[model samples]
Target chain A: MKLLEIKNLHASVAGKQILKGINLTINAGEVHAIMGPNGAGKSTLSAVITGHPMYEVSEGEILLNGKDLLSMNPEERAREGVFLSFQYPAEIPGVSMVNFMRTALNEKRKYHNLPQLSATEFLRLMREKKAMLAMGDKFANRAVNEGFSGGEKKKNEIFQMAMLQPVLQILDETDSGLDIDALRIVADGVNKLKSQDNASIVITHYQRLLDYIVPDFVHVLADGKIVETGTKDLALYLEEKGYVAYN
Target chain B: MCEEIVLKANESRDIVIVNEPNVRLRISQEEGSQLRLHIIDWQSADNDVHIEQVASNCVTEIYQVAYLKDNQKVTTHTNVRHLVGGGVSKQVLRFVLSEHAKGDFLGTLYIAKDAQKSCAEQSNRNLLLDDTATMRTRPQLEIYADDVQATHGATTGQLDENALFYMQQRGISRQAAERMLIVAFLSEAIETIRNEEQKEKLLNTIDSIL
Candidate 1:
């Protein structure tokens, strides 16, 4: 089943065009990798999809499960099971991880007409997800991403993806600052969370991450468009030849 | 110039002032005494607090939080003096203004020549929620003893837009996200209340208003 469809989508930031005439379709149980050089509009594509206020969709449309995704706000898009693992996750001081996650989970549940989880139940769920990410108990009490190491911040993003259980997950440069060990742990968490009913878009600049997550299809984005599409071997080929050809 | 409040030797007191249009109080502390004062204002108010540690081994704490809107105004003036050695003082103040409201804060800290081994810290943080709202903050400190440690900081600005978007992306409505940020900003002052029931009540009231 098709999970997301982007048709000739064009987006701009600060009144300057970034994504121009891009088309893509993602289906359930599929992992699509978007590889590109810097300034190729890779991050802009993810930002526009997640309804970031800074990016405006000037033309075309995006559909999630055949529903209009462009009409929703960021919060509404999130409640609809759209998640983006930010390249630079914002550090929010004084907001505890438990409180933040609980609010998010309950809001999604409310959107689905499900009952809210009690405090005990929510804590239990948090513990389960934290253990899945190999995070310690202290992680639950600390403020969200405040003073966290780079590796810890990436792990926190995956941990949130685990908690929210989003259907359309966009991993925007999630492996940017990870060491070898942190990368493996984050990849393992992503692999564990994959299901037949969900899909993922892994946006990265290197092929090292694909060796672990393994994408079904790889597309090379350049100059505000996807200029090339191929199997996983395309990432390996780009790693050897470099994006000099595309640029 | 209200009645002068005096703390005898080894005495401790926790005082809370809420929503008074005009507040004026003078407090004197003797040796080994402690005072915890909390001021909360929801409407327009002018507050003046003067505290003096006359003897050694005195401790003083002051916390204030004010939220105003719709042409409401609040002014807070605090003067704290340490006369002897081996004393500690801390002050935390916060104000949130919206619409056409205005806020002003003046904080003064003085340490006498004999007040060696004294430690003092003061911080004032304000938030302006609208374009028309305004805030002015001035923190003044004077330390006569070279051995004393004193620090003060003041800042006035709008809410963090990045933090707001982060919460919104996590499925929280914008209104709800803003409320959470505001409460977190003001929690530093409210957390200083020693009374559990009073603290909870104040939190609920602030939550409802936001």
Candidate 2:
């Protein structure tokens, strides 16, 4: 099934254009890697898809499962199974991880017309997801990302993804600050969560992450457009010959 | 009328005053006495709280939280005097104003010349939820004793926009996210209430109003 379709999408921030006439399509049961340099609008694509308030969609339309996504609010987009693992996850002090995850999960469930999980059921689900992510028991009690290390923050983001079970997950620069061990753990979690009914968009600058999460198609984004598309070998080739050619 | 109260030597007390309008109180602590005072207001109110540690080995704590909306206004004035050595006093005050609401806080901490080795701290934080809302905070500290430890700080800010957007992206509505953040902001003061039942009731009341 067609999970996501972006046609001629154009976006800007503060009246400055970032994503200029970009097009992409993703089907269920596939992993797509978007590789680019520092200023190639890679993060903007994720922002535009997740409906970040800072980025304004000036033109074009985004569709998820044949429905219009641009008309929805950020929360509505998230409840509709669109999740973006932020490159810099916000740290919210005094808001416990348990309360936050429960609220998000219950909100998603309410949107799907399902019953809200009870406290016990919610705690059980949290434990299950944390175990799946190889996270410790103390993680659920602390404030969301407060006083956490860089690696722990990234791990917590994946733990949230495991709990929310978003259909169209966008990993925006998930490997930016992670060490080799943290990267391996995060990649393993993503691989374990992959299934036939969900799709992922891995946005990264280095080819190191692509080796672990193995994208089905690799695309080079340059100056707000996907200039090249090829198989996984394209990532290796780009690793050798930098983005100098795309510029 | 101002009410007079005293904590006897070696006595301990936890006092919680919620939404009482035009509250005025004068409290004193004796040797080895402990006092925890919580002042929480959800509506427009004016409160005056004065506390003095008159003897050595006394402990005094004060926490105040107020949430006002519409055209409501709240004013709090606190004076904490450490008159003797070996005394400790701490105060935390917070307010959230919305719409055209207004908040004012004047906190004074004083340590007498002979009150050496006494410690006193006061903090006042406020949040203005709307452009038209106003907050005026004045934290005064006067320490005549050279050996005393005294600190005072005041700050006013709005909610964290980044935190709001992060929660929204996790399937929580903007309104819900806002409520969560507001509650979290005020919880710092509310958590200091030693009485769990009273704390729970106050939380429920604030939740319903918010």
Candidate 3:
């Protein structure tokens, strides 16, 4: 079954057109990789999906399981299982990781009308997720992304994903700036969390990540539109050829 | 409203004032005395805090946090005088205003002659949630002793939009995210409470208000 369907998506930022009419569909358990060079509106697509206020949806319809997504606010979209693993996760100076994740988790739960998790249960869940990311106990006590290294920041994003367990996760350049070891660990965590009921869109510029989290479909996004679509090998072809041909 | 208090030699004092209407105190510190104070205001409160290190080896620390909303106005004025050598004073003050509320803070630090080796520091930060809310801050330092060290800074501005958007994208509602950021912004003063239970209560109170 289709989990997300974007119909004629047209979005803009600050009165400048970026995404000119795009369409895509993702089924359950499928991984879609969006590969493109700089200024191809790669991040813009994710921002519009998650309802970033900075972007204006001039025209489009986004459906999550046939429910209208564009009508919902950012938090509402997140509650409905649309997550964006930001390329640059925000540094919250004084908000602790535990507090941040717990608040977000509880807020999602509350939206679904579930009872809040007890403090002990919540802590245990945090510990489990942190362990999955190969993070330490001391991490939960520190401020969110305050002093984290690049790899640690990306790992923290995955840790948050593990905690939230969003169904439609959009990882925008999650592999960027990651060392080989950190990339493997992040990919491993992503692989472990994959399930038939969830789907992900891996947005990146390099095909190196596709070797780890192999995408079922590879789409080339250039000039705010998907120029081409192919199988996993298309990622290889793009890596060999680069985005120059599409541009 | 105006009161005079003194910390005797080697004396240590801790004070916390919350939701108080008015505060005016003239504090005197003797040799080796110490004073730590926390002030939190929510309503219309006028405060004047003055401290003088009359003897050597005196220490004074002040932390103030005020969260005001809906037309509430608060003004706090602080003056610290290092009259003797070997004195240390530090102050941190923060105010968050929303919905047409107004806040003002004036801090003055003075290191008199012969007060060599005295050190004083003061910082004030304010957050105006919306364009309607307003804040005024002043940090004044006068040092006559060439050997003393003194620093003071004050700033008032809106909440960080990047930080707010970052939280919203993480599935936290903008309002909740703003509350979290505000609480975090005020944590410098909140973390100073020594009593755990009181600290938790204050934190909870701040959260509930947000």
lDDT of 3 by residue, B72-172 (tens): 99999999999998999999999999899999888988899899999888989999988899898888888889998888888888888777876776679
DockQ of all predictions against the true structure, Cα-based: 0.78, 0.91, 0.77
Q: In angstroms, give how far residue B98 of model 1 lies from its true place.
A: 0.5
Better model by DockQ: candidate 2 vs candidate 3: 2
In model 1, which regions exceed 4 Å deviation? none
Candidate 1 residue lDDT tens string, B1-210: 264899999999999988988999999999999999998998999999999999999999999999999999999999999999899999999999999999999999999998999999999999999899999999989889989999999989988888888888889989988888889889889988989999999999999988
Model 3: per-residue Cα lDDT over A1-247, one tens digit each = 9999999999999998999888999999999999998999999999999888899998889999999999999899999998888999889989999889888999999999999999999988988888888898899899999999999999998999999999999999999999999999999999988999999999999999999999999999999999999999999999999988978
Where is the poorest 10-residue window by lDDT in model 1 chain B?
A: B1-10
lDDT of each: 0.93, 0.92, 0.91
Better of 1 and 2 by lDDT: 1
Candidate 1: global Cα-lDDT? 0.93
Using all chains and alpha carbons, the TM-scores for the candidates as numbered come to 0.98, 0.98, 0.96
TM-score of chain B of each: 0.98, 0.97, 0.96
State each candidate's clash count. Answer: 0, 0, 0
Candidate whose lDDT is highest: 1
lDDT (Cα, tens digit) per residue for candidate 2, span B94-177: 899998999999998889999999988888888888898999998888889999888888999999999999999999999999
